[model samples]
Target: MNKRIFLSAPHMGGNELNYIQEAFDANYIAPVGRNIDEFEKQIKEYTGAKYALAVSSGTAAIHLALRVLGIKDGDEVMASTFTFIGSVAPILYERCTPFFIDSDTASWNLDPNLLEEELSQRAATGKKQPKALIVTHLYGQCADIVRIQNICEHYGVHLIEDAAESLGATLNAQHTGTFGKLGIYSFNGNKIITTSGGGMLVSDDEALLSYARHLSTQARDDAPHYEHNEYGYNYRMSNITAGIGRGQMEVLSERIKRRREIFNLYQKELNIIEGLSFMPELPSSVGNRWLTTILLPVHLSPEKIRVTLEKENIESRPLWKPMHAQPLFRDAKGCINGTSDTFFKKGICLPSSSSMNNDDIQRILSLLKPLLNC
Candidate 1:
């Protein structure tokens, strides 16, 4: 059998071990170490954020962001319905009511029009409006952030950009994560870059981030002995993982370039297939192209293609099922237009690892051409 192809997997740069060794040599093995501080600095410099906090996971960052934003029990929070649960789980953690916004066809992200409508309707009805809007940049593509930000500002709601899949994505020369009040990035093993498992929270508000840092480290107050005045969480990223992140940052641009190249190859090879279409990339936005996704014909099953790929030691996956469709979130209020539902039914994520070479791409294409009848 050939090497197993992945949907998306970590491609390490050569410097990861050096940073790890430095951490070990310095004996900074805990979460609070030079590596963590350096990792945060690197992220802030890359994202143009005034502050950055290294956290245990992207989900932890979201939860901390919500807490910092004053989200509480029964407060309304809006999120993209088509994203991974990590984007919405934090709202639930705060015991907030989640209102899901449908996806826009162009970006496969939160629809700004629906958001405006939801906010307007809520305001008109004299009901409590959402306290925060969590917008996800799905599949490494920036959402229509300019318009969404305008809407959030008009409604007096905070915007939290979930850029876990869009670390290198930019729109109109602005980074996706920087467009919102607070943003997050993930460095999970399968992301474009990996720190084994870690995440970062970024913002222009230093005070807010300082509070987040305090809360993330068990909310210990300034004292000589162990003390805490508020509930807190152990969500800080460990020095070892932050060391990996520091090294990954060194080659982030190269990784983004390679991933985009992979997307281009897949687009060139597969776009000609009948009954298949690649995800649309907006002209003004440069996506990291985390996974090259395609829409299959209604008659075809993404599961069948996924199974076929699996038989050949390749990994493929169906697109995210909308939160509204999930049994767990079935009761959540959503402005439904069936866009996410349609996407879930027909969308397929192809092998898009940055480590893949042309030969690997050709092999996958050869197998897919017949199945798709291109």
Candidate 2:
């Protein structure tokens, strides 16, 4: 049997070992260490953010962001139903309601029009204002931030960007994670880069970053002995993991370039197939193409091609099951645009690992062409 191709797997740069060695040599194995500081610094510098806090996972970052924004029970947070569950789960964690919005066809992120409708309706109910807007940049594609931000501001809501899969993506040269009041980046195993298991919360607000850092580390108050003024969580990233993040940062640009190259190759090879359309980047957006996706025509389902790829040991997946469609979130209030449902039925995520070479591309194409009847 051949090596199974993954949709997206971690690619490491050689510099990782040096950072790990430094961690060991310095005996800074705990979550708080020079490595963690350096990693946070690097993220801030790279993303042009004023502050950052490393965390255990992207979900934790979202939770912390919500907590910092003071999202409490009964507060309604506006979020995209077309995104991964992780992006909206934290709202539920806080016992807040998620007022879901559908995606715009262009970015596959939240639709500003639907957002306005929801907000206006919610306001008409004479209830509390939506606390925050959680928008995801799905598959490294930037959301229509200029419009989304405008809507958020108009509604007096906080903007939190779930940029876990889009660390290197940009819009007019501004990085994805920097577009909101708070944003998150994941360093999971299948992401463009990995800290093995870690994430970061970024923001321009110094106080929010400081509060996130405090809350992540158990919210210990200033004192000589163990102390706490408020609730806390064990969400800080370990030094070892941050070491890996530091190393991954060194090759971030290269990985983004490789990802885009793979997308180009797939687009060039597969675009000719009938009823198949490659997901495109917005003209003003620079996407990393975290996972190359295709929108299959209605007659031909994406699941069929996914099954075909799986049979050949080449992994493929359908696009994220819209949060609203999930049984867990079925009760959540959401406005309909049909775009997310349309994407769910037709979109397929293809093998898009940065490590994939020309030969790998040929193998994937071989499998896909036959299924596509091309």
Candidate 3:
């Protein structure tokens, strides 16, 4: 048996323990501490956001963002159908009705054309439009955000970027998350960087973020005694986790570099194979390449390939099943095109951990080449 390879796994910088030790030394073990403050500051600086609030998870950040935006029962919220449930679950948490949009063939993110169609139809019917549009930067790739932003603005809808898998991604040298009203990042164990489990909500609007921070910490009114003015959630990131994020932030650029290198390596090696195509990279966007994904010809079974890789102790996974197809969202209204369904059927996520060296990459290729007949 060989060492198991993961599709995406935590890659820690050597300095994580130093920050953890500092947290211990300062006795900042709770969610509120210098580490938390510093982590939020670093995220703001990195993403060019005016404010950031660290929370327990990316889903929590989304929930807080929706709550701060005043989403309520029966309010419509539009989200990309081609994303993890984390991006859509928050809408339901806010008691908002979800309207899903399909993906563009090129960027594999939300399709702005479909978005316009949906919004235009809603406007024509004189019905209330979605309160917000949650655009996900899936697989670290930036969506056509400039176009999407224009559509959202035209429709008078707030945009929230789900940048969970795209922390270091940028478009025309601008960060992906900053173009929207609010954006969120994840630092889960399997993300580009990890804080074990944490997320950050960022925005240029300080008042909104201040309210979000208050709400995340149980929405207590300013008083010495325990008091609450409204509904709140225990969603703050703990100091210990923030310490991990602080150290991970120090090495984020390098991690992005390595991940991209991994993507390039995989493409260079496997793309020559018949029936295989790598995910397209847009010229204007620099993606974090969090996971190297490929599309196989219809004849090749992605599940079979995944099983073969698993047998070799290498972890591979099918691309996210479009949310519209999920049993949980079966009844959710969606503007449909066949793009996302096709992607779901043929795409596979390859091992792309930044810790993997060239040899590790070669090992994976060697195992796959025969199976793929490259």
Q: Which candidate's lDDT is highest?
A: 3
Query: Residue 189 deviation, candidate 2, in Å?
Result: 0.6
Residue-level lDDT of model 1, residues 219-247, one tens digit each, is 99999897888989999999998989999
- What's model 3's lDDT at 244? 91
What is candidate 1's TM-score against the reference? 0.98
Each model's C-alpha lDDT? 0.91, 0.89, 0.92
Collision pairs in model 2: none
Say what the RMSD of model 2 is: 1.2
- Over 4 Å off in model 2, which ranges? 121-127
The lDDT-based order of candidates, best leading, equals: 3, 1, 2
List candidate 1 segments past 4 Å from native: none
Task: Report the Cα lDDT for candidate 1.
Answer: 0.91
Count of backbone clashes for each model?
0, 0, 0
lDDT of 2 by residue, 279-355 (tens): 76777889889999989866787888888888889999999999888999878887877889999998999999999
Candidate 3, superposed: residue stretches over 4 Å from native: none
lDDT of 3 by residue, 28-63 (tens): 889889889999999989989999999999999999
Model 3 TM-score on a 0 to 1 scale:
0.98
